[model samples]
Target: MKNYIVASWILFIIGISLLTSCEKDPWKFDTDRKPGLYFVELADTNEISFDQLNDSTWTRKLFICYLIGVPVDYERQIEFAPIDSASNMKFGEEYKFSDAILKAGEVYCNVYLWAKRPAVEDEDGKRYCTFRIVENEHFVPYMYSTAFFQVRVNHPREPKWWDAEIFGAWSEKAFQVYMRYYNKQEVENTDNWQKYYSTVYGKNMYIMNDATWEGVPALFLPLLKEDVLVPVFDYFVANPSDGVDIPEWYYEWKKN
Candidate 1:
């Protein structure tokens, strides 16, 4: 009977141990913990416009952060392996990721991808690159973040009229018309012609050469439609002889 009681006690202890082992640990899949890998800007593909080629390269940023719960103090070395078959954009040819592998020891860190110029320009062709962040020893990548790792290159635009010598004479005439009306208004607020010129074109035209205006539009049409500036500009254009006559279009504009 003593032996039987001892066996029963042993079975009870075993059952308790099994129950304890089955309980979920606080650290695993904790509700409060939200550790993640992410991009700072959420887009499936980043766009590069070779047409607006003012700079040598275009850049985008990637970030990794702890959302709700911080993991144990640890550092991770991130890796990006380009999927060559899936992309026409070649690494070391068209693009590269900067600051890719490093110790991510803080709350958040940055990784950058740079796309270079003379990007394979095609009017209707698709040019792109897909890069993937592989699994590393320290952190598991969020699948959503990995899916959108892409860069798309667009075709450059051909040079237009604003890109030639015609722009200089046209800008001078437009500025002359603006000044003529300014003197007639008799409103002596000390705003200079350069400021007025900047307002008409949205940037300082004096500083920009014709080659820099390749994709830009002519200033006259936009200035001719402006409410305050156009009335004066229209008057001078219609009455270049310094007469007191207002055009029918000005009266019509004022009536409305």
Candidate 2:
């Protein structure tokens, strides 16, 4: 009888374990029990710069991303419009967006900002607008309701990692080259490396009690290489822009 009780208890425990293991992951699913989406990198206001473009009619893009659910097999249109009262942007004079579409088999889509060079630049070289994603056949709103985009004639602020002795003086060309490889937002790239470090690329090297990251990260920690550095020099040589001079040391790198 004691052996029979032990066998029954074992069977009960095994049955419970099997049931628990087969249950769906609670954290992996959407909060609404349905598909949903949100704006990427727009927890707060972000800028769309015309600093790199020379054309009178220039363009940039904002991403409309999925916060939940997997990528679908077909395309879906994300419908949005400018909030008239909140937006200061003059539609034709300053900015307008192209089709907002989540492409086939993708989690996000582009809202193209087609910018026009205003006859007069906005005060402080910036114009602001807000857009909201509405209820659609594809997705329901998840967390963020609205996103802000600024049209700005932003000037490049040199990053702290830039060594003047090695790379020469920081210029627009070098900044653009760094951005192309560094793959970060413009404001984060220009700010102090310490502040940028806090969020991106966790510095958890030690195994013991030393886990919290503090006081600046290494300059281009995993990104510094000959391939990246070569482009900066190549850009200056290729786009010398009339009167500007190229630094003497950079004449060696053959464009690859």
Candidate 3:
């Protein structure tokens, strides 16, 4: 009888251990703690053709912020716009590439901005604005302009462990920890590495001509070699509109 009780207790303990080990981490899918998104528009006239107002030539920048709960804490973020389109041009207003190439008259383009939600706010909000094109006296649209695009913000995925590790690092010790465990398997190429790293690191590292790892032995290099950087090269080759290049170091590193 005593042996039976002992065996049952052992089984119970084993069951409990298995159950505890199998318990899903509550934080894994909890996006409730994510940051919020802030969107803004910036104008550029560098591409504008002075002679051809109707020509699609103006440039613009759209900024998206990923803040940590606090809206004010939002930092430098991604920018997106269209390419090679003609629309009305205003002397001082911002215009996206999509806005630049509308029909000579009035037209519309739906603009979107994506970001994370504040940790406390269950529901986020979206802001809508308009873009207008006014023709010059010649009845020919000479200037392309946009008041500002409607900035519809949406909550993106919360930062994963690796994201936090890479972007949160402020010291050598912290950086090394990021370099050691963050999975590089998903980062198939240099462009992928750049996008992933920038999303997590909060800055553009792949574009950095002189980026280097500090605080660790020189032998423990975390830099991607050129051959291994093929993915990034192929990405740029495929998507020239992205306006970024795969650095020469990546190609050099790949040859080895």
Per model, state how many residue pairs clash: 0, 0, 22
Better of 1 and 3 by lDDT: 1
Off by over 4 Å in 1: 1-23, 30-46, 50-75, 101-105, 118-120, 123-125, 145-256
Give per-residue CA lDDT, model 2, range 1-256, as digits (tens): 9999999999999999888866755655644454777876563467766664233356576565564677767778777666767778766566777887778777766667676554345724356777777878777776875777766665556555555544566676555555554443333444523444324432221121232223333344323334344555667566665433455545544432
Q: Any runs in candidate 3 off by more than 4 Å, and if so which?
A: 1-212, 217-223, 226-228
Candidate 2, backbone clash total: 0
- Please identify which of the two predictions, 2 or 3, would achieve the higher lDDT against the true structure: 2
Report the Cα lDDT for residue 89, model 3: 25
**Which ten contiguous residues of candidate 2 have the minimum total lDDT?**
203-212
- Once model 1 is optimally superposed onto the true structure by TM-score, how far is the C-alpha of residue 134 displaced, in angstroms? 1.3
lDDT of 1 by residue, 178-213 (tens): 444444333443254344434444332333333343
Hey, what RMSD does candidate 1 come out at?
Answer: 13.7
Selected candidate, larger TM-score, 2 vs 3 = 2
Rank list by TM-score: 2, 1, 3
Model 2 stretches with alpha carbons more than 4 Å out: 1-34, 91-93, 121-123, 154-256
Q: On residues 1-256, what C-alpha lDDT tens digit does candidate 3 reach at each position?
A: 9999999999999999888866756545434443322223334321211121111223233432222232222222222333224322222243333222222222222333222221223222222224333333212211233334322223222223222222332333333322333334345445644544444333323223233343331222344322223443454456552324345554555576
